[model samples]
Target: MSGVAKVVAFMQRSWWRAALVFAVLAVAFVVFGRYAVPPSTALTSGALALELVGTRSGAVAVLRAFEQQHSVHAAWVSITWDFAFIASYVAVLVLALRYFARPGEPDLIDRTAAKSAVLAGAADCLENLGMLAMLAASPQQPPDWLGFAAFATTVASLVKWVLAAFAAGHALWLAWRKLAQR
Candidate 1:
């Protein structure tokens, strides 16, 4: 078979894995909606870290505040998590478009591959946000307020690690391109 035909067949076979991702995301979304949980309030490391720290800074005060406003506030926490998803989604989609379309190739558009990649990335984001949110919103917590300070610190470190990976990836990509041009 020709090169193009071979690639097309490969994608068709692999498409099932991609569909499964979206199906899982839909289930998670339904669960989150039922719980009346916004993704940001539930997920997003930075925001959860903030709440953890804030709760620690003055536990009585934090409890008092949460009790007072938790009932009154709109479901805006999801908005924060939603923003994070958009950012990650765009980055992943850009990377996917580059890979599938392979701009240097004669065909400028690999429409099926490009579209599939974006859908997969979005599903990944939703799943991640859902997982994090569920963790943050869990009923169980340390009996002592001070322990949550430690939780905040741990989350901050994880966020740092995530950022470092992205920065390293970007630097490497740039360096590779520069050397290739030489």
Candidate 2:
């Protein structure tokens, strides 16, 4: 088998491991997310500022205000925490689609959906990088690459959510079918 095929086989066999990782990281994301920013501020900016800020100054101002309330260190740590969360989230969702679907030979659609989970995870990682870069630079006078980072972060965040929603819907459908069989 090719390297990619081998990796897929491994993933197919490792659903429980992925679930364990997801459980651990989910806890971290929830805890650090709470300490990183206020719940009200989250409504406005969110973890990676899912809402469009439209301008570099606006983005910087928001980050600065966030840092003032919660130290920049917490914000940085939260961004790092997101990395772990994204990886585990993708793995568990994709593994579920792979192994928990109707018991039969896998089809092209199943494979594609699993791959999309990885793609979504990649997009999320890019989103995290852009957010971290912006947060790191926000303390400066003008903030380096503020426009590009913020724009990329927003776009990636949107892409990640769309793919995530698809995975979630697919998982639910599989779950319903499984339950109906019982």
Candidate 3:
């Protein structure tokens, strides 16, 4: 079979595995957030981080605060865990799109949804890298590269969400039409 066909077959057969993996990763994220990062911080959105830090000095201050909270190790661990989360999230989301289109070939809505899910995961990985860079340099002023990282993170994040929204809307519309045709 073609690679695409193989992937579709795998997704069709193993969506539940993806779901289980996603659930474990989700729980890990929540636990890590509670102990190390705030839920808002976990998102790793550059705009949101800048809003929290306010300025270079603010970044130092916040890092100090995080240190004082004795959550630094947990925070670092969470950063590493993010990779697993990203993989699992993408798998689950993409598999869900495939599952939704099962018993037939995927139409445009399913194809779009799968593509959007993959894009969102890629964007999220970029955002996580940006956050890790900042976190690694915490308690010190961020480098000039932070600006670029932040810009990339913000733009990618926006694109990811918008595409996901379009996918969701399409899914809903498609579902409605299917029901109406019955």
Candidate 1: pairs in clash: 39-78, 42-133, 43-133
**Least well predicted 10-residue stretch by lDDT in candidate 2:** 42-51
Q: Write the per-residue lDDT of candidate 2 for residues 1-182, one digit (tens) a residue.
A: 75434444664576675566457657765665554444455434545453355358767776777667764555566667767777667756765675556566667767667777888989988987777777677455855578777787788888888888888678778768866887
Q: Could you tell which candidate, 1 or 3, scores higher by TM-score? A: 3
* lDDT order of candidates, top first: 2, 3, 1
In candidate 3, what are the lDDT values of residues 11-80, reduced to their tens digit? 4566585466447657765654454334544334322553234345555555566666665555566666
Best by TM-score: 2
Give stretches of model 2 more than 4 Å off. Answer: 1-54
Q: TM per model?
A: 0.31, 0.73, 0.62
Residue 123 lDDT in candidate 1: 46
Candidate 3 differs from the real structure by a C-alpha RMSD in angstroms, to one decimal, of 5.3
Question: If both were scored by lDDT, which would come out higher, candidate 1 or candidate 2?
Answer: 2
